[model samples]
Target chain A: MKILVFVKQVPDTDDVKLDPKTGNLRRDGVKSMMNPMDANAIEAALQLREKHGGSVCVVTMGLPMATEVQKKALGMGCDEAYLLSDRPFGGADTLATSYTLAKAAEKIGGYDLLLFGRLATDGDTAQTGPAVAAQLGIPQISLASSIAVEDGWVYCDRDLGDTVQRVRAKLPAVVTVNGGINKPRYATPINIMRAQKKPRTTWTAADLGCDMTKIGTPGSPSSTKKVFEPEKRNTDTQYLTGSPEDMARALADLLENEHLL
Target chain B: MKSDYQGIWVFAEQENGKLHPTVLELLAKSKELQKHNGEKITAVLLGADVSALADTLFSYGADAVLLCENEALRSYSARPYQKALTQLSEKYRPSIILYGATPLGRDLAPRVMVSLDTGLTADAIDLGFDEDGVFYQTTPGYGGKILAHIVILERRPQMATVHAQICSPIEPIADASGELIVEKLNIEPDGDYEVLETRSAEKSGESLAEAKVVVAGGRGVKTEEDLAMLRELADLLGGQLASSRPLVDNGMLPHDRQIGQSGATVSPDLMLNIAISGSVQYQLGMQKAKCIVAINQSEDAPIYDIAHIGAVTDYKKLVPALIAKIKARKQ
Candidate 1:
């Protein structure tokens, strides 16, 4: 089995803050980390390889700094990593991003499975994974909590809100894994040292034979018109200042007075 | 030459021959948007044994229902659903299409959009049409830190997916008149994906989304045992136990009990947030709760900004006391 995993570097959302005055993201001091869900995807791939005897290669499309994530994937036991970085690829929406990734995957062919995180923290759009599958003309199972491959068939447990469905797809399919699929293993010092010497390749848009017209913001049909903070509700907040017990009593009194208790 | 696309279309999602509530909600929203352009609100439905749903759709605001029934569509496999929907859209050329952002919709919408070579905005909270008649979709982006106004330029059948409960379903008009077009769809179930079996999780009580009172925990709840305390609190309050994404991701709670963008959107009458430092993503799910009581150790936690009552103290101490006080009151 040859598996391909998609990884992304996103700002640590917990540290991301909005400047109240300007209403813009304060990205100056925020650090970037591999999307938490992507870690699960990589871990799923690694586990499948361990069970079925295969190789795992990771791919990412972002700035040069994204290679740091590629290195981390290698550190986590992936065999190879590719970084699809170019200025022309900037601001690509899910469609264009999937186009670029599909083209790159075509170039890096001979893979039986493609995996991605359920959603990215930054965009929160679960579109790219399925869009990529559509671009590649393959079947996709999104929000997969558990997956097993045997006899050229991939069985997945999809996490629908109200139900858990067991689905099976032929090999050479795309699947997106959600969190808690598996506990990702940490990179030991030896693995980290070996990862530093692993094969890491960076490709430009031209290198992937991407049509310049369909590779970036110019090709993306969707555009963000504005970014603004949601309007805050004007509710009077009553602060109960005291010891823990006092505050508990006060809250109980408040709820009682309001007939909520 | 006039543009080919006309009328607003909604993908009326159904499972087990029952219409998902979000479809009617989208229909209600579509009816509102259609008034601006004076176009018909059409529903495109693809499933097995779903012809009987056309009347319900008409009563809910659909001017016409396009029903594509086939045995292969008995259970949702992405390829057949995408192919049917894509074929219908190409034939009718709708100006705008709406999908509910459920697991099925999130999976099928992107495939359909990609096949049509169009863009789709996911999990849109609001929808409207501009003076130029382009659809303006509003969705929370950047981890719910910012709202993004998205538009697809020069695309026919502009598409979007909205989460449930974002819009109210209007009262159905009795004996509403509408056109029901039955299309013959012949597709083999021979796809890359197949469903072997489905096991719906045993649900003991009301879902977190439908709960009137939600007692939610976060990463601040240190151990798995602590969730039992929160559950006790919830049980005493006649509510349900919910959690932020971290607790769910950490496997401290089930995915369905998660309250966040990727999980469930809950608008309860009261939200008791315990040991939760409210992140933007978590807030997006419960922001609509009529009253919020946040108890965290940090006074400056962002949850305080939106909470009606803030208690800066250790939840381990405050929660037990609050629970005891409530139990006494009950006595």
Candidate 2:
């Protein structure tokens, strides 16, 4: 029942905007935190470890600052944490990221399950978990609301478009849990202090023996260099005032003229 | 990496004998791709008893339909569907494959991409080739701020899951026909996963993205009663009722009616936004509306920046009055 939860650090708010000059996220007033859904993944892993009597580990792939997420996971009861960080890992897309993670999983050795948040807040692709499972050549159950393990099998209640399916897969499977999975527990002050002493390690692409051609920008087949300004609708709104009725009348007139009435 | 894969494909997604709506849209887009590279258009369908769907696929512009049927694929357990599609892909060697950016597509396509050892762009909004004749997968990414035209320079069978409503579906021809290639694998290996039980879930509010008129509310919409008032206006205007994510999370409205990055992408003729301050996520799903009318208590709400008509007043008073005025005009 050793569970590995993969989390990511994302901008704290959904209101994040890109800097027009740099074509990158504007980090002036924003803070980075563990992606909200990943907390549920960590919670699911910690709960499973509590029941099955094994250690829960958390892993994240990003810059060195991504250890913030690892520490947060540790404070929330994860037993071990690792950061997959290095220069070569920069500019990796979901494919390269999943490949690097698969290599890390192989390097870590011996885990019954791999868990992920349903999606990263910033990326929003929700493709990495299934890709990692495919990379590992293992079974995967995604969009899970609940997950349970028994006798070397992992069962999950998965959310599909028109049905909720209760599915079970063998050990060494991957599961991506949706935000509705569970209410993540808050970290206690004592646990936060204890987390400082937890066994932590940082692995680079070289240390993971990652194929240099497949670890970063070179490994990522699809590339996006076309950054453009989002289309803006002119906002010269003609304010209709006087009274509610007057405003409504003006609006109705506008709609009628626009052939929308 | 680019040796000899020849066909352009659209995944013909169906359930219980009915085609997913986005399938038609994907086929329409794939036809545009076919014209670009001189490839034959294909509709690759997978199901237990979906042979009859080939006719619909042909009518909607598929030059051929690759139907892969197996009992294991009757329900979409990721492994078996992934295996079947992957096997068929290797055998057929399509040069370009497109899927609808749906939950099912999102679940299945990536695994197949990994198995095929190719790159896939998720939720692409457009597709085209550059001056160099290289394919570009266009999507709104980086929190919807930048429109990225991504390129897969070296992969065969370049793949992407296209956003719904990104393209207009081609007009279907009557009694159209195409080459129907039925593939039944010799061994439909069982997956490690088992489906023990299933119960029906909800889809987004009946094509909210395709509505001609959309009346959307947000956090200012407090309760079901308030929603009902908005619903009244929607019904009067012959449109659909939509809400920003807050109402959906509060359980007052189902996920189908939610409008934002995490939910459906809505493009309507007229979008009447009431009380929603509009987060980046919410605005991205919309912003395609031909007309927007914003009414909020605060004059400084960001939604007003893009709204064609603005009312810096309480929605309660403004909405009720607007409804009354519309009724009078109709009479």
Candidate 3:
């Protein structure tokens, strides 16, 4: 079995500055990191590789600088790293994104399982994984909290609400992992040395056989009209007094008065 | 053409056979937005045999309910739901659409927005339209450090997903009526993804969102053993236990039990904040608590900024006494 883990390089949401003119997040000068959740996906894939004896290839779609992300994945025990970078792939939304990734996955070819974080922290949309599954015309299990392989198939325990949902899918499916699946492993010293020498193969829009018109900003349908900082809330807060009993009674009264009780 | 945008839409979120309360809340608020702006409130309900959920939608202020029922949508999958909703929004062209910021809604909304070529504002705390006919969606931005406003100027239907309980769910009126359109779906000719089975959470138990009394511990709780006191207090109050981001980081509680920005945003009736400094991230989660009581040794802790009752006593001593008082009241 061959496993491919999808990783994205997002601006450290902490470092991303708001563009005063466009109101969207400023991409320039912001430090970037592998989407935090994708680290867990890479970890899950490495464990599967160790147990199932398969090659793990980590893939990402971003700018040229994203080679650092691929290197990070390699250091974390991935057998190979690939990047699908093209200026045309910039500003692609989830729909177009899934299409481009599906095409790249087709280019990578012969993959049994695809792994993704439930959502990228920077975007927090949680749409790309399922969207990619839809584009690829495969089975997908999302928010997977635990996973195991048995009898030529995978069983996933997904956390939905308060209960764990046990789901099964055949091999060669896409799985989006939520947090707490497993603690991501730190790169060993030897692996860190090995990552620098490991060659990173790159793919462009043409390499993936994607339509140039729909690959990036041109293909994206949504546009950000304005982004202003959120307004501060200025509500009058009243502090209650006396013992617990008195405070409780006063609180209940306030709730009733506010008609919230 | 003055934008030609006409109506407000609600993605009526349903799980299993029961409808989510936040859907009704959106309807109520949508009705208010409609009344305020002379617009119409339309609801989109997509599920298997979900028309049954429509009757209540009218009472809650929707001018019409659009029902799209399909077994393919029996479980909440991003593919089919997004496909159907994107088609509906394009066809009818609502001016604004609202979704509850539940996991399902969060997943579905973005996918639909992607397909429709529109942007979405997630975790919006407040919403209203401006004089120029653009929807003003407000959300906590900058990692809870600041609030951000998003405006969809060129987009046809401005989209937003609000956390539940920020707005009140109004009781449905007895006699409200509009067109009931049953939309037929024509999804992508061939879909790549399929949902085999979905595990639904049991409907019972004290969910953090619905808990009345939430005893929350912060970094000051110190250790896992300290949480037992919080649990005891929660048990006495017939409530649930919650923790701030610090406790989650400390592994004292799981992420789901976390009550703050990165955790669950909840609006309980009574919340006890134990040794919490009330960072904006955590406050964003519990701002809806009806009566917030803070227990901290510091007099100027940020938790006291919004707390209705604040105690400067040490949580180590105050916790046991609070539990004892609740236990005595229960007996």
Q: Write the per-residue lDDT of candidate 1 for residues A111-167, one digit (tens) a residue.
A: 899999998877878998998888988888898989899998888998876788888
User: How well docked is model 3, in DockQ terms?
Assistant: 0.23
Report how far off residue A123 is in candidate 3 (Å). Answer: 2.7
Alpha carbon deviation, residue B49, candidate 3 (Å): 3.3
Sorted by TM-score (best first), the order is 1, 2, 3
Per-residue lDDT tens digits for candidate 3, residues A1-261, read 799899999776443456677656666777888887798899999888889898998899998989878888999989888899888898886657888988988888999899998877565557788667766756677878887776667778776655566777777788898767887888777887888877678988888889886678776645444455434344444655566555555544543464533
Candidate 2 lDDT over residue span A119-212, tens digit each: 8867778899999999998988888888999888899887763567888999999999887678799988888888999999999999999989
What lDDT tens digits, residue by residue, belong to model 3 across residues B1-331?
Answer: 3267678899899877688888988987786687667877888898887787788888887889999888778777666777788788878888888998776776667666656656577677677766765568766543444455566655567788876666787866787676899988865422444345555554433579878778898868876678888888777667788887656543457657878653677888888898887755678789888878888776656677788777666777666765555445446
- TM-score for each of the candidates: 0.92, 0.83, 0.76
Per-prediction TM-score of chain B?
Answer: 0.84, 0.75, 0.77
Q: What residue pairs clash in candidate 1, if any at all?
A: none
Cα lDDT computed for each candidate against the true fold: 0.86, 0.83, 0.74
lDDT-superior candidate, 1 or 3: 1
Q: Model 3: runs farther than 4 Å from truth?
A: A10-32, A150-153, A209-212, A223-229, A234-261, B1-6, B32-39, B75-83, B86-95, B114-118, B151-158, B183-241, B244-252, B260-284, B290-331
List model 2 lDDT by residue over B87-153, tens digit each: 8888889888898887789988889888887789988877899888888987765445456778887
Q: Output the number of the lDDT-best candidate.
A: 1
